[model samples]
Target: MANPQLHLLELNAKTGEVFLRLRKFPNIILTPPRWEDEPLLIPYLNDPRVCDWLSGPPYPYTLQDSKDFLARIKPPADEVIQHLKDADPAAAPIIVGECPVWSIREVRGSEEVFLGGISIIRCENGELMGPNGVDWENKKKREEENNALAVGDPSIIWTIGDWLAPSHHGRGIMTDVIRTLLNDWAVPRMGVRHVWATAFTGNEGSVKVFLKNGFKLVTTHENHVVVKGKMRGLHLLEWQYEG
Candidate 1:
């Protein structure tokens, strides 16, 4: 609470970057991944306790993997800024033709700390989930064949994914992150009407994070996906934006 509005004021004073401030935690912000994040990204992600709940990250979470991830998630900062200007502040973070990803960051007076990542991915039609979980294998094939990112297509489904370092868990930081993203950015600016997410049924913390942000449990897929040679039950949650 001591941080006050200065955190945002300081962040916004800088040029050529976008920072999504968490409504409750004034020091916490979300910004596009930077080259400097590579070193920290590896360690935070390598924690099995953190990785087991996630779907995209592979085990070990090497430095090269972090580099490629940072390289690949290219958020159009300029476009987002322009949209903000056009809307006079209430603007969109459209990953229309690019990836909509942001690094979870904590800021002190002069230092910014990388915490984790939050991204809204456009799930392909009829491919949100398969029998064995996320159906990422087919999703990759579609990406490889099409060589194109979703371009605000009406039919495309949007889903969000996020991870927080183990050090920050149980404090409800992720709940605030999702709430800030939806209420401050995704809903008001991007016109995100619906977003879906999945979590292992047993992972009550993850499930609670989404539910706290107004996501409703829609279904549970028993033995939905195979992870580490074992089947895991995954539950689906959906958030419908209400203006």
Candidate 2:
């Protein structure tokens, strides 16, 4: 059977950001998620706070459900990295840094530490998806169509996702974590100049994070996302760095 490693290269786009060409993370000292993390991930997924905005995998997300999820989530060796340490069932692990793309923990340290993940589509010149340049036929089309681009033009924008353990909530952990990822990682590694985030309109907490982090409210679309069988509005936000 062909190893999944063979497909790992597929994770990169000639036009997007270039990841380190190996399995191990360079410049990051985080542990991988052990099988035990299933329990941690399960409760978070089932949390109404997190689940409400996400497209459902069904309510009452269970340990079995998390197991199935982890089982299916094969990390792309080159582009996707998962860090793990044996997690103590009693508490959340301290994470110092995380995968810049998916925001998975890459640096685990103190228990109260907060980690955030960020992903930026790297756009490069002379590639199949579309060559990099001023020509944004593909990107404009994606914006106009309300379509999902698996990874977007790296040069133009970075799609950021923020994840935090429940214990770390409401104390500016997520905001600080996001700032750290953008300042310390994404801009440095991926040359990301702009950050984009989508939050369900009703998710005031998330929207506040984006706003507090300097993302300007650009637009809103009604019925943009389906969650729990209902359509909800979504807010589009952007933070640009002119420097």
In candidate 1, stretches whose alpha carbon ends up further than 4 angstroms from where it belongs are: 1-11, 14-16, 75-101, 128-155
Which regions of candidate 2 are displaced past 4 Å?
1-34, 56-58, 68-74, 77-156
User: Model 1 misses residue 63 by how many Å?
Assistant: 0.9
Score residue 191 of candidate 1 by CA lDDT.
51
**Measured by TM-score, how close is model 1 to the native structure?**
0.77
Error of 1 at 171 (Å): 1.2
List, residue by residue over 1-243, the lDDT tens digit for candidate 1. Answer: 212211231235665465778889989988867788888988777787788787787777898898887777753644544443354233323332333338888888888888998887664323444455456558666544333434544334567888998888898799999888777666544556667788987899989999898899988878877876668887888887666
lDDT of 2 by residue, 1-243 (tens): 312322221222333322322123332322223355566666666777667765535677887887775564324422233222233324433222224234334333433122322333322211112344223456555443322423323345456655555555686656655665566545553346766677778878788888887899877777654667788886777888767
Alpha carbon deviation, residue 205, candidate 1 (Å): 0.6
In model 1, what lDDT does residue 19 have? 78
What lDDT does each candidate get? Answer: 0.69, 0.50
How many clashes in each structure?
A: 2, 18
